[model samples]
Target: MNVPLRDPNIVMKLSRLGSFHQSKLSFLRSFLKEFKDWDYKRDLFELNEHGYGIAVYSFKKKNRVYSLICFANELDENERSDRVIATKWDAAFTLFDGVPAKQDIERLKNEVPKQEFGRLSFKELTLSRANKSVRIFNHVVESLSKGVQPDRELLDKVGYLYRTTAVYGSGKFGLADRFRIKDRKEIYGPFRLEMMLVYLVRQFTFDQVNHVAKNKNPKKAVKLDPEICRNLGIGNSTGLGMAPFIVNHPTLLNNWISARETSLKKIREIKNISNEEIELFLGCLKKSIKNITSWNTESEYQIKKIKSLLSDLNKFIMYLDKEFNFKQDFAFNEMYLDLEKNYCEECIEYVVSMMMEPFDDIVTPLIQEMSSEEGKYFNIPTERTVAELKAILENKYSEILNIDFSKKENNLNFWFISKNKEEPRLANRFDENGADLEQPLAIARDVKKLYDLLSVSKNSWTIAKFLSTNNELRHVVRRAFIVEKFPYSEIQDNTIGQEIMPIDMLRLKLSFFGALKFDPRSDKWLRICMFQGAPLPEQLKNYDEHWVYN
Candidate 1:
């Protein structure tokens, strides 16, 4: 049986994208899987009694090596701030292209802790800074120093000892330009180096806590149990800066959503399923429920989302247990159709991620396709006629063309880069002073503008001639052609809408990174946990690929 891919109009909605959960294709899981056989080592640990010093961790293969150099510093409680404006953090790190020398470490020691103000050579691939969860870190240290484990309930509530405020890569702050390392086969996967930095950082946190505890009481201190360390992951606080990523990298965005949709389409086409595959699917589905039930969020909006997801999942599980039969042909296809009719977007997308767990053959190739050579689509097809361009916009942007941008509410907000932090920020058009400085991120509004202008254009005129006069809308024209080839390339909603939830945009991007526990602090920023329930570095050689559900 052949099953068609889900329409982009339905699957590309911001609401559906925001509800996306991590699957086997997630970069974090793929990162671990790719480097599972690489040699792991901690070549240096020089922290003082308070865990304020330097450390180093690395993953080495036959010739290629990537090292994470860590710098732990003293941060007074009053000076530590997770907001981007902060100057100091508990620790800062850089993932070097290979192992570093004494001079290289000394050079970064003075600069890494300075973060943005610091200068990094091309050898540093990724840079990041994390602040300690002071309460949790101290509690763990105190408990371990007294020869006891910290309260498991408390540890699970706040999942990490440190939460990174930002992770920067791809040449930001003088790091190595991606062009320099883009050809490395092992690191071809998106954000592979960044994931390595964070995963190694997770290990650093455990080591630092143990170091501090042992220093406090040499006689009674004990190492944190490996099981408990496995439960903890690195947390992160992300802001509107991430919202523009999907808009800026449309091809990358398309590849991510495309991989997922392709997986679902292939899974639905299967004519038969073996008992082992069914058991693995059932096991992952049942265990993933814990991720939802244990989800902790104080935001009323997120609380509502979680409640509906849990509620719908209960109904779906009951249907499977009491009514559905796997013996039927094209069973998953039928189950998916039924889900769309009966479930919320959150529940439906959640199940879509779970459905891929039992099919490694379907997912492995898709992972390679997720990275994009975006420059291939940069040039617009200006030789096409206005009539062809008009039809493309009309078909591809059916919903966007209907939006009334003249409405005050439709033009209520603008996106701009902040002068202080040099990061993406969202602000009100009427209330904020930066409207004139607004970045060209409002693709929906601009696409509508293009469509309106193209309406009166002569159908016989070439797009190159049309652009000679309407050059101001050239960006959207380039995007329109890109979207013509890539269906999931453009977001079909108004990014400048008064009702826009910037968190929704952030959530969409983070979901692709395998982040969990989306606890929104506001409409502009949120906190999430990554690498939770993932295997430790030493165990990566022989670990369960299904650890995400565990």
Candidate 2:
């Protein structure tokens, strides 16, 4: 039996997209799987009593080596800030293309810590900065120095000792452009290097905390238990800076969503499932409950969603344990339909991700297809007639066209780039003064305007002729053509709407990164944990693939 892929119109809405969860295809999980056989080492460790110095770590396989050069600095309590404009952080790091010599380390010492202000050569593949969770960091150090493990409760509350403010790659701040290393087989999946940087950073936090503890009391201090270290992953604080990425990378976004939809379709098409697959799926679903129960968040918005998700998951579990039978044909398809009919968007998407856990064959191949050669789709098909473009817009952007842009609520917000930090920001169009300089991120509004203009234009006129006069709509015209082929390419909602939850955009991207425990601080920013409960570098060689649930 063949199952149809989920409709893009329903899946592409911000709320549904925001409801996405990490699956086997998430970049970090794939990154770990790919590098499991590679050599892991602490090539250099030269920190002082205060853990203020340089450290180097590497993952090498055969001739290729990717070294992470870390520089830890002492910062006063007042100096640490997670804002993008902040100049100082507890630590800074860069993933060097290869092993660094003394001179190379010295060169990076003066540059990596400076972050955006400092220039990076092509040798640097990814750069990032992180601030310590001072309260948690200090508590762990104090407990370890006193010959006791830190309070696991406290550790679980805040999952990491350090939280990176930003992780930069793809030629940002003069870093190496993607073309320089895009062909690397190991990194063919998106953000593999960025994952490497964060994973290695997780180790650095462990090493730094241990070193500081040992220094505080040489004889009694004990090493942190490896189990504790594994549970504590790196934290990341993300802001609206990630919101515009989906709009700017239409083809890439489509590839990601398409891969997910395809995976679901293939999984649901399976007519028979073995007992082992059923056991694995059931086990993951049950173990994953801890993740939901322990998900701590103060944001009422997130809390309500979590509550609904947990309640629905419990209901599904009761049905699975009591009424559901694995002997049924196309069982997953039936399960999916039941989920959609009974659960909220969050629960349905959550179970969809969980369903992929038992089918690596389906999810593994889709991972490579997530990255896009976006340039191939950039040029508009101007040779086509104006009527063709209008039809494409009308069909591809049906819900978008229905929005009444003239309503103040529909056109309430504007997105603009901050001149100082060069980051994307959202503002009220009515209350703020920057609507004139708004970025071209309001795709729904602009597409509607384009449709109104095209309604009266000559149907036979070629797009080239139409664009010659209506050049302002050329961007959306290119997008319309692209979306004609990539159904999930365009979001079906108004981005500038007054009720828009900007965190939804960030959550969509973060989910692909394999981040968990999304703790939204506001509508515009959130905190997430990565690589938590993942195997350590030393254990990667023969680790359990199902460790996510473990």
Best by lDDT: 2
Error of 1 at 337 (Å): 0.2
Q: What is the lDDT of residue 166 in candidate 2?
A: 88
Instruction: Specify the poorest-scoring 10-residue window by lDDT in model 2.
Output: 373-382
Write the residue-wise lDDT of candidate 1 on 1-550 in tens digits: 7798898888887888889888888889899999999999999999899999999999999999999999999988899998877899999999998889999999999989999999999999999999999999999999999999999899899899999988999999999999999998888789988999999999999999999999999999999999899999999998988888899899999999899999999999998888888899888888888998888889999999999999999889889889998878989999999999999999999999999999999998998888999999999887899999999998999988889999999999999999998789888888879899999999999998999899999999998999999999999999999999899998888899987888888888888899877999988888899898889989999999999888
Q: How far is candidate 1 from the true structure (C-alpha RMSD, Å)?
A: 1.2
- The residue-by-residue lDDT of candidate 2 on 1-550, one tens digit each, is 8788888889999999999998898899999999999999999999999999999999999999999999999899899888889999999999999999999999999999999999999999999999999999999999999999999999999999999998999999989999999988899999999999999999999999999999999999998999999999999888889988999899999989988999999999999989999999999999999999999999999999999999999999999999998889999999999998999999999999999998998999889888988988888777899889888987889888999999999999999999887789998988979888999999999999999989989999999899889999999888898999999988888999987999989999999999978999999999999999999999999999888888
lDDT of 1: 0.92
Error of 1 at 527 (Å): 0.6
TM-score of each candidate? 0.98, 0.99
Q: What is the C-alpha lDDT of each candidate?
A: 0.92, 0.93
- The deviation in Å at residue 44 for candidate 2 is 0.5
Q: List runs of model 2 lying over 4 Å from the truth.
A: none
